[model samples]
Target: MPDIERKFKCSSVPYPPIISCIALLISMRAITWIGFIIWLVIRLIIYFIYGRKHSIVQNESKD
Candidate 1:
């Protein structure tokens, strides 16, 4: 079970950084704060949706 959980956990770790990096690069080129804000909102939404579900607390409860 932990091994399966690790696979899910490992996959998500790279996404946030990659997304933020892309957002930062685009904002730099476009010279607009909106793109960064959009990215932040997206990240927050993802956190609320997926992050909460995969949290340690939630996993502990499952056991």
Candidate 2:
């Protein structure tokens, strides 16, 4: 059998307009204020669940 290469592609996402318009007024803003806030909330939940393990690894690498 011959070897074949597969490529990965990402599709564009539609951000909501209301909060996003504020972000567009700024430069290089991907998600507007609403997106940013939503992201933070998700990140906080992930960190609360996994932060301890990551902190241990970070400390070991630093020292």
Candidate 3:
């Protein structure tokens, strides 16, 4: 049978590990921000095109 010793025995916070984790978190945040900006630009472009087309169609129908 495997011994189920205390899990906290080796739970020491090391500098490199902490720094790596912080860097990883920062990178993840940056990636998310970039994706959000890209998505926003795409949505705006699509909406603008749709709006222009809609107005043109409406004007044609009125004439």
Candidate 4:
């Protein structure tokens, strides 16, 4: 898999156009901005819930 990925740059090549299409779709209102807002809120909530517990900096500070 690493050899194939290196030979083709498969990991990086496919993502940019997919991201661009999604961005364009969102800008054109095909996907709805409200859904994006909700997605962001959920991401923030999950990060607040889980990120602090696993943070290396916070654990190191405690020591």
Candidate 5:
């Protein structure tokens, strides 16, 4: 599962930061901030709900 997650993140994560950088240069409007806030909230919720439970360090310590 961790391997799969690593693979997925490798493919997906880098693009978002790049895209967000571009998006920021394109606009600093209200909607962009709103969307960023919503994205952050969702990320936090997911981290608390799932990521914290399934983290690699926690799994390794069990072994």
Candidate 6:
């Protein structure tokens, strides 16, 4: 009988794209903050609307 070993590999982005992404973030500082705030508001609204309805505590209280 022979023993065999399996290996897993992962891929990563090259340095060029990584540098471009950092540059973009630095260039769009104001827009980035605005977008972040908008995203947070939307997420909070969703959590209050649909998330709370489907929560375990709410379900338990219903019974």
TM-score of each: 0.40, 0.33, 0.46, 0.45, 0.40, 0.46
- Write candidate 1's Cα lDDT for 1-63 as tens digits: 644545333558888999999987776855357787899999999989897888999989999
Worst 10 residues of 4 by lDDT: 1-10
Give the poorly placed runs of model 1, Cα more than 4 Å off: 1-31
Measured with C-alpha atoms, the lDDT of residue 42 in candidate 5 is 94
- Summing lDDT over every window of 10 consecutive residues in candidate 6, give the lowest-scoring window: 1-10
Over the stretch 8-58, how does candidate 6's per-residue lDDT look in tens digits?
534564877889988888888787789999999999999898978899988
**Whole-structure CA lDDT of model 1:** 0.80
Give the count of colliding residue pairs in each prediction: 0, 0, 0, 0, 0, 0
Instruction: Give lDDT per model, in order.
Output: 0.80, 0.72, 0.84, 0.82, 0.84, 0.84
- Model 2 lDDT per residue over 1-63, tens place: 346665753454354564587565775555566798899999999997787667887769888
Candidate 6 yields a Cα-based lDDT of 0.84
Better of 4 and 6 by lDDT: 6
Ranking by TM-score: 6, 3, 4, 5, 1, 2
lDDT of 5 by residue, 1-63 (tens): 544545333568788999999987688888878999999999999988797788999889999
Q: How far is candidate 4 from the true structure (C-alpha RMSD, Å)?
A: 5.9
Residue 8 lDDT in model 3?
66
Candidate 4 C-alpha lDDT tens digits along 1-63: 544545444568788999999888767773567788899999999999798998999999999
Provide the lDDT at 19 for model 2: 58
- How close to the true structure is residue 52 of candidate 1, measured as C-alpha lDDT? 82
